[model samples]
Target: MNIEWSALGSVIIWGILIGAGLPALFALGVKTLAVPAGPDGERHPSLGRRVGAWTCFGVIILAIVGAVAFIASGGH
Candidate 1:
């Protein structure tokens, strides 16, 4: 019946940062990598490819951080 507000806040913040923030960043990366024709509607680089690369990078970083945190937390 007891709740730890600090732990709850940490979880919420990490969830938001990983869940929404990573996707948003990936979107930004994709947008930046996209090539647009001058008023001709031509496109290159492919949004999907860019998004994948961004997501992979984000996931790697998250995994490393998570691993370090887990080790530091004594796996508790």
Candidate 2:
């Protein structure tokens, strides 16, 4: 049997990077937007946190859209 070691390594590396990286980024956004409860049980995320979360979410959405487009276009 013949095996393409380089191709296999590349797929493994990229699979881990993208598979883990996107979720890690989304988790970071969730952490950024989280607020601890105050004495009055109120929580408010800062504007920066809101923006960061939205930006992270936007990137995820964009990636999904691009993937769908690529599949629809025959992944050329």
On lDDT, the candidate that comes out on top is 2
Reference-based lDDT, each prediction: 0.75, 0.87
lDDT by residue (1-76, candidate 1, tens digit) is 9899999999899989877777776667666666766476765566676676677677757877987999999996
Q: Indicate which candidate wins on TM-score.
A: 2
- Candidate 1's C-alpha runs over 4 A off are 37-76
TM-score of every candidate: 0.49, 0.79
Q: What is the C-alpha lDDT profile of model 2 across 40-59, one tens digit per residue?
A: 98868888889999899888
Question: Cα RMSDs of all predictions?
Answer: 6.3, 2.3
Off by over 4 Å in 2: 38-42
Query: Count of backbone clashes for each model?
Result: 0, 0
Clashes of 2: 0
The local lDDT score (0 to 100) that residue 53 gets in candidate 2 is: 93
